[model samples]
Each structure stands twice: as C-alpha cells, then as structure tokens.
Target: MWSAPTTTAALLTHVVRGAEEAGYNGLMVALTRNADASAQLNELSEEWTSVHDVTGQLIAVLSPDPEVRTAKIRYPIVYECAAMHDLRLVPPEDHDFGFNRCFVGSVHGDQLRGRAEAVPPRPPQEHRNAWTEAASRCASYFGITEAQIPAVLLLSFAERTAVLIRLRPRSADSLYDLCKQVAADLGWTKRAAELSARQRALRQRQHHLHRVVDRPELSRAKWRSRSADRLGSRMTDELRAQYDGLDRHLSSIAEVNPALVQQWRARLAELRSHGTVEETYRQLFAIRRHVIAPQDRQKWRRLAAKVGKVIAATDRVILGRYTQFWNLDDADPITAELRRQEAEMGRQGAEMDRTATEARQELRQIDDELNSVAAELGDIKPKHDSEPGLAAATEAAARHMLGQIDTDTVDGSAGLAGYTVRVVRPMAEAPVEHIDNSLSGTVFGPMVQAGHIAGGVHIHQHGLWARMRRWFS
Candidate 1:
C-alpha cells in the first residue's frame, strides 16, 4: 500500500510521477492548506519539471515549453476541495486533454497489490476521529466551521502511500468505494490511518494553544471608567491648551499663505504621476517653493516648531495618565519627602567622610615625624660618649621637634600635637647608656628630660641623642 510521506511536496511529486507513468494525461491534486491552488499547481509543475519517462521524455508534459513535448500540453489541476466543493473543477477550455486518461488501476500493476490487500483497516472510532480532525483543520484554515465543508472522505493511492480526498456534494459514493478498494490493493490502509491520526492530534493541540493564548481584553465600560479616574482635570486642560496653541499657530500660517491649499493639491497630483516612490518624494521637495510664499516661509517654520512642542506636550500628558493609572511614577508627596531626606543624609555623610580623611592624613604626618626623630636618636647612641658636639646636636633636634609641634598646632592639628607629646614622653624616659657620664650626656640628658615636662600643650625633645650623633659626624 502507498503510505503518505511527511512532506506535501514529496507526496505530490510521487503521485504525479506515478500518474504520468500510468498513462494519465492529467491529474487533479487535492489541496488541504489555505492557498491559491492554481498558483501552487503552476509552481509545482515547474519545480518537478525534471521528471522523465522510460524513453527519457520529460514526464512533466504539462510544464511550459520548451522542456515538454509541446506547449499545448495541459497542466495538472489543483483545487481546494474544502473551499471549492467540486471535483469537476477543470483547466481552461483552450487546453487539450485529448491523450489524458485518468487511471483506475495501480501504476505498479498487480506486483504490489497483494501486499497492499493484506493490511487491515483501522477501528471505526479511529477513522471517525481522523475524519473529524481533517474536516476541522480544513475549516480552521479557511476561517470557517466544519459544517461549511461537510463532505464524504475518499483515498487516492500512489506507491504504498494514501492521499486523503474530501469529496464535494455531487461526488459519487461509488467513487469513494472504488478509491477504498484501490487503497486496499496498494496496502495503504494502516499508513493512511496513522497519518490521519497524527493530523487530528496536531490540529487539536493547535486549537487548544490558540485558545490559551488569545485572552479577552477588559470591557469598554471598565476601560473608560479607569482611564477617566486616572486622567484628572489638570491633564485634560493641559492637553486642550496644547491642542489650541497648535491650531492657532497653524491658522496663522495658513492665513499668511493663501496659496498653500492649491499648491498642496497640485503637488499631490504630480506625486501620483511619478514612476517610483523616490521620484515622487523628489518632486514633492521640488514643488515646495510653489506651495509656500517667500514671505510666509518663516511663518510656516515657526508653525512647524510650535507643532513639535504641541506633540511633545501631548505625549507627556498621555504618559502621565498611564503612569498614574499604573502607579509607575514616584510622584507621591511622601516619596518626594523621603527622597529629599535621603539626599540630605547623603550630603552629611560625604562631609563627615571628607573630615575623617583629613584627620587621618594629619595623624599619619605626625607619626612619620615621630618615627624620623626616633631613628635619628638611635643613630646618636653610638657616638654620644666620644663626641663633645652632642650637646649642640641635641639642642638643635629639640628645637626642630618643638618647631614641628607649633606648626601642627597652628595647622588645626592640636590632637596630633598632644599625641606626639604622649609618644615623646615615653622615649625620653628610656635610658641611654652611651650618654651616661660624658659632658654631651650632661647637656643632652637634661634637654631630653625637659621635653617630658612640656606636657600635652606642646611637642618637644626626644631626638637629643640623634642630634649628638650628627654633631660628632
């Protein structure tokens, strides 16, 4: 039995080739899709133009010359069985079908007939479902109901595949029986049943999906009431004012340019007569001088600018209405107050951060100076007993340390000065063995001890040993 293939093109080509080889002059194709059948047939004829006969003659005899034997050969007829409701739909009267004879027997003869007859028909319920689905799909495709295309089903066989055929009102029941017999002979019963079931399931799923996706909108009354609530008197007045302003501007421009109407009409006529869209647009620009008077061109320019402003105002009003209805804008008084407070807090936070950063910088500077002094003091330890210059160096270092403290105090870093005093007091108290009994030690030791008595009010003396070493060097 001939089993239908997945693609329409494959099935159509196979059937056409089979019919041609079986000595059929012309074949009628049943179209299931919503399309122009005649146009589709013409295209198909060209697409399958390379099919050949046993003697290497082009099998698609209906193709346009000069590929076919003659240009006079009639093309295959394709009809929308559901839409047309007629099998007698024929080609033009001028076309010849003299050599064409519709085949009733198998194209492969009895060679495959026994195999086709062995396959059994599907259950009645399956057959009914298949039939209903096919009819429903045909109706949906044409945007009609199943009742509009009420017709008995028929099957046409080619190879081992079966093509579903929907017959018109006048179609003979005997023809359907004959087709069934032909299908059985070709062993296409099981394959045809399977294809029909698949088609039914696909159409059902599509119908369900479409229904799910197509949600109904709110009623006109509800929509109108909601829009009215959102669009207050203020918005309406603004929109009306914008509209009136645009109208007044346009009126003024029109009054200044009395020839504008006549010029527009003439330009429109010229545009219609042009060969292409680009040419029409070019002519439109060329006729601008004829349309607008020289003195009124500036008025028109002003009017155009006013129109742009009016459009922008209208867009804003509409957007405002939608925003209010959807609660999309943060325009509530409470929200505005919150935002202002947040901004104030952010500014305060930023100022505090800046002050803290400056304080840290000042403190780091103080720590660096203290560390320098300590390093210089450590260097002085080895040389203090040997050198007499230790006293002058120690005095100089105490002077530098005191100067740094005064400078820090003047720069508004009094906290750094106090911290420096606390740091220096500890270093001054630490014993220096190298400077114990020497004259350098006598002079420097007292000076270093004097730094501790300066208190937190001033920063002094912890680098006496460092100065002594520098003096000796």
Candidate 2:
C-alpha cells in the first residue's frame, strides 16, 4: 500500500497516475543536474516519451461519474528538462524552500515546464542591514516614523518595492507641489479642501448673524414682521380707501351729532397712527375716559364700546379667525367644558368602584362556603387507597375515560346524546356508596346522574360545569 517508486519507469507511471487522479492534464519535471549527467536526463526523457501518449489518451477519456464527466477535459503533454546547475544548493542549516530557492512554472497549450534557480547566499548582518536601510528610507519618505520601519520590512518584497515607488519623488515644481501630489494620492487634499470650504461658509454665516444681532431694528424687522406686517403694508392703500368710504357714510347720517362725528374722526386718525387694530382699541379705551364731555360721556362711552366690538371682529377676520392669540384661562369656554367632563367621569368612576367592591364581597362569601365544603370532602380518603394496585387501576381507568372524552370532543365524532350514553353506561356500574360521608351521598349521586342527563342536553354546558367543579374540588 505504501511503496516508493524504485525505477524511472515506475516513477513516471506514478506521476502519470497522480496527475490523472488530481484532474490535472499536464506535468512538468525540472531537476537540477550537472551538464555531464547525460544518463539521468536521457532516462527521464525516455520515461516521459513512453508515458506521454498514454497519459493524454487517459485524460481525454469521458468518465461515467457525473463529477468527473462534467469536468473540463485536457490533453496535456509533459516537458522533461534538466537544469545546467545544482539549483537545490543551499546551506545545510537553511530548510525554508522558497526563501532560498526561486522557481518559475508556466503552462503553454497542452504542455507544462518550469525552471529553478538557487538564491546566492549573503552575509546575515549585511542582508538585514540592507533591508532595514531600504525600509527606513521608504518609511521616512512616506512620512512614517522610523519605529514603523520594521513593520514595513515585514511586508512581502513586492509590497515593499511598491511602497518605495509610491514614496519616490515625481517631477514637480517644488517640494510643496510634491507634497500636494502626495496629499492628493492619500485623499487628504480632498478632505482639506472640504474643511476649508466649510470654514469659509461658517465665517460667512457668523458675520451675517453678528450684523443682524448688532442692529436691533434689523433683528426686530426680521423676526417680528414675518407675515402680518409684510401683508399689511401691501394692503394699506385698499384699507385706507375702505376707511374713507366708512367716514363718508358716517358724515351722511342725519342722527349723528357734529361733536360725536369729530370724536369718531379723531378715533380714525388714532387708528391710522397706530397701524394695527388691537393697538387702536387699546389707545381708544385709554383716551375715552378723559376726552368726552361730562354731559355726553355716557352716550360716547356706549358708542366707543360698539366701535371696540367692531374692531375686535375685524381683527378676527384679518388674522386667521381660528387663531388663539392668547392662552386660555379657567374662564375660557373650552376649559370650562373640559372641567365639567372630568367631574362627570370622576362621579361615574366612583360609582363603578362602589359596584365592583360589592361584587367582590359577594364573590368572597361564595368562595368561603365552597372552600369549606371542599376541605370537609378532602378529609375523606378513598377506600381503594389500602389496595395500591386497585387504586392505581381505578386512576388509570379514569384517565383513559377522560382521554376518550377529549378525543370525542376534539373529533366531534359523537353528539351530546352519544357522549351521555357512553359516559352513563360506565358510571352506572360503579358504586355510589364509595363517595365520602362528608358529602351528602344521596344528593351527590343524584347530581352526578343529573349531570349525565345535562350532558345529553348540551355537551358544551356540561363540559364547562365539569371543568369548574374539577377546579374547585
């Protein structure tokens, strides 16, 4: 089972079989030898030539196994070449293969070939110093500290070379230009540009905020007159025309006294000065007390009150009618309504609590009576307890009967009458005298019989009462 190939032909056969088993279609042999060793080269060449044809034919054959049949078929040829020197030569202490030896393998058409070369040895100290110097230079150029040079050296040779190439200076105008290029490659340039733009925008916003804050008029105009002041200015001419028409109407009224007319004109002038209806109302109320003559003060007060009502109504129309300009107090209609509802709910909740307390008291009395009856009945042990086997058999029979009841209930295989017949037939044969004396045996026996009758009347009703009785017992 485990024999090494001893001859060239056996080795070649083994290699061919292995290649076939591994699903490989080709093989390459690269053995280092002296140029004078022609015999070994001829033997290997002959062995390959003999097996090459058969190997190709075997690889081309379609396998019956689905896994093998679906695989891509390859007609591979072997390349037997001898190296001119001993490429395997290395110090006896060095066992690492790829580190000391380099090999190049390639596949062409249906053929595979390879070449191996030994890496010449260098003094250990010199080798390490050269690598350290290269890593330090790369790390320094890339702005990495000297401490990170070891990590840089730990990378593969190709990766280390890539780092060196990246750090190498390109043709640029100056060091700053080179630094810009490096920053761009590292993506720092884009981030710095973004930060600079954000800083400029932030400064611009701060300047604008300072200018607004420094001027009180500007701040008030910006914040306070957002809507009404702007719209009011646009509608001022139209509103003035309407007021003028109203004044003309008042002038034409025959019943209006001249002094009252003059007073109303003064009010209109005050309205124009105030520039808002609410402010005009406030000023009118303040002036009303001192301005009117004592003889006409009562009538003028009534007229001023009516004018205030009209101004309030107009204000509601100009601003949104539904808008609540001030917070509601306890006297507000909505607040009054909410309080009334809360009081009604409190009264209803108290009534419900009283009713629930009465119900719980009644339930407690009923539970006490039931629990007393249960404790008295529980004191009487079953007579079959002295015979363990008989007691167990009785319990098993009860469980079986209950299981049958559950099955019948779930399957709906029998109506109430059928269930009653099945239950009563078994129970009628059992002795009612076995019931404890603590229970009224005569009453309980009849009640059990009545329950069977009720089961025939309605299975759901009987089941509900049965479960409740079981839980209480």
Candidate 2 Cα RMSD (Å): 50.4
CA deviation > 4 Å runs, candidate 2: 1-278, 284-302, 322-473
TM-score of each prediction: 0.15, 0.16
Model 2 agreement with the true structure over 1-473: per-residue lDDT tens digits: 01111111212333333333333222222121223223322332333333233322111111111111122332111111202121322212124543222221111211121111122123323322323223333333233343222221101111111111111111111212222233223232223333333444445555544433332221223323432342234334544554565456446541547776677767666666545544543444443433334465454434433333433344344443222222122334323433554565467767755655665565555456556544543443342123223112222333332232111111111111111111101122335566543444355323433424533453345578889998999
- Candidate 1 residue runs with Cα over 4 Å from true position: 1-177, 193-201, 213-473
Q: Where is the poorest 10-residue window by lDDT in model 2?
A: 152-161
lDDT of each: 0.32, 0.31
The root-mean-square deviation over C-alpha atoms between each candidate and the true structure, in angstroms, is 48.1, 50.4
Which lDDT tens digits does candidate 1 get at residues 214-248? 32222334333433332223246766576456555
What's the distance in Å from true for residue 361, model 1?
72
lDDT of 2: 0.31
